[model samples]
Target: MQRWKQYGGLSGLFAAFLAAGYWGFTATGGALPWAKRSSKALQRGIQEGGGGLVNLGRGIVVAGPIRKGGMMLEFGGLVLLLLLLGIGMYVYVDRYGGFGDGERASR
Candidate 1:
């Protein structure tokens, strides 16, 4: 219940998550590969001239590493988790209203 304990726990959690993210980023070849991909895409776009900005037939393109590495299921799961979290928060807010003090506002 102490404030210091709460702060320490939060700091520890943040450090753990930051380390894990850095590990993931390094293991996945970091930003170099992505930079190269972006450069090539830009050059190709310049060479190819104009086309329809929104092509319904093409659909959305998943990143090459994720698609090639077969992380689609993990990606989908993360997306679903975030979507559920957002909806849950929305429902909780709608049911309980906001944190504003109604009495203070009326004064």
Candidate 2:
């Protein structure tokens, strides 16, 4: 029983580490594909407009500085969410003993 408890604690810690690593990798990796797609779409929208007044308006809203700013905001939000999850996981592991604290210690 005692041995099993120790193993359980270690396993929990390992699981927490794995979860954090996966979340970080996916969040960082996912941003690149989205950024590329957004850039391409913006470019297409700009080219299709062909320098007319309509194009100018479309360009301002979709393909111009606003689009760039929106992308930055999205990327910033993704990074912030990942950071918050990481901090939450760290706190969870710290307080919960990863697996579960021994019953005797809880009192």
Candidate 3:
């Protein structure tokens, strides 16, 4: 794996993901609807809501868009996946070591 090949592959993957994300955004009515809903929610909350910032009784509340759009499961799954990936990386680096001074000095 040459450096150029690695960078090129990453660039291609990024472009593909960007295109897919844009397509999905366009197909799903773009950001207009979301922006409108967010503004309305903000105004309504300001006018009619007053409570402690952190309510332990209520537990965790998902964002309004994710909850209302029925994507809570997807959001949760993504969060779990990322959390596992992060923990796995941390464990791997702790056990096998990363780019430490010894490794860098050899190079």
Candidate 4:
């Protein structure tokens, strides 16, 4: 009999990725209190067009810290997925013998 053990780790990793993306996007402009400040700062900067607005807008983008964090989160998720798959394969092999028919035993 072939035994298949499903690893929920991948799902967990996917969820983490989704959460990180959500936080990143929402942090820029969501229900979060800081989002309001960020939005206002961005708009004001765009309007001013000069030093004040330009600097404010640039500061907002730079201060957000989303780009680098997002990349790290994505990489972490990928690693989690790989780890889960590896563990699942290991469990499957340990329980069901090898990858060939020879692994199966006659009843």
Candidate 5:
């Protein structure tokens, strides 16, 4: 595509290098090491502090989890933040329109 070509050749080369690195890592038996490390680190930090920035934001969106007949749904913490982020995005699009249209009301 012209857009891909419009990017300097280095972009394509960089993408190729990234793909090759991922392929080599997978071939060498690395199973999503980045994801594993990030999750463990996040969990450790949260456990040590009992709550972090995400917890604060979650508090704004949810009071706590809800429990029903033997079923429980976690609404507080990161889950609430994610929900808030999604709803915020929807509200933004509803007010300002979505991507790819390029037209917007002048401020």
Candidate 6:
């Protein structure tokens, strides 16, 4: 019972931290918030430029500025995703013993 409570508390704390960071960064227009704006900018760039994915014959080539912004967004998102995944895996391993009882049945 105590272990369950600890696990629950940890999970809640992680969630709250993630939510706060996302909201705070977005509100402050930080680098992380650039991810959302990238999609819109990509569309506009395609519309203005003569090259885009849809026009496969010419091959897709995003504008230099838009591409640079997108790379930053992608890198930031990758870091966040990796962080969450690592935390989740750690929680799972902690909740259920990673190396289970090997040969203690007779004991």
Whole-model lDDT values for every prediction:
0.84, 0.76, 0.86, 0.70, 0.69, 0.75
Better model by lDDT, 4 or 6?
A: 6
- Which tens-of-lDDT digit does each residue in 77-106 have in candidate 2? 876999999999888877775646565345
In angstroms, how far off is 59's CA in candidate 4? Answer: 28
Q: Write the per-residue lDDT of candidate 5 for residues 1-107, one digit (tens) a residue.
A: 57767686878888999999999998876867878977998898678775443555464322223433322344435577898999999988778876547666553
Model 5, C-alpha of 91: deviation from truth (Å): 0.2
List residue ranges in candidate 4 displaced over 4 A: 1-69, 101-107
Give the distance in Å from residue 45's predicted Cα in candidate 6 to where it truly belongs.
Answer: 5.4
In terms of lDDT, which candidate is stronger, 1 or 2? 1
Instruction: List TM-scores for all candidates, in order.
Output: 0.49, 0.30, 0.52, 0.32, 0.29, 0.29
**What's the C-alpha lDDT at position 4 in model 1?**
100
Which lDDT value does model 3 have at 49? 73
Model 6 CA lDDT for position 76: 61
List the candidate 6 regions with Cα displacement exceeding 4 Å.
1-3, 30-57, 66-107
lDDT of 2: 0.76
Candidate 6's displacement at residue 82, Å, is: 16
The TM-score between candidate 5 and the true structure equals 0.29
Which residue ranges in model 5 land beyond 4 Å of their true spot? 1-75, 103-107
lDDT of 6 by residue, 2-64 (tens): 999999999999999999999988789788568778888888878987534566676455457
Error of 1 at 12 (Å): 0.6
Q: Which candidate number has the best TM-score?
A: 3
Put down candidate 1 lDDT per residue, 1-107, tens digits, no spaces.
99999999999999999999999999999999999989999898799885665578975566678989999999889989999999998886666664564543443
- Model 4: how large is the Cα RMSD against the reference? 15.2
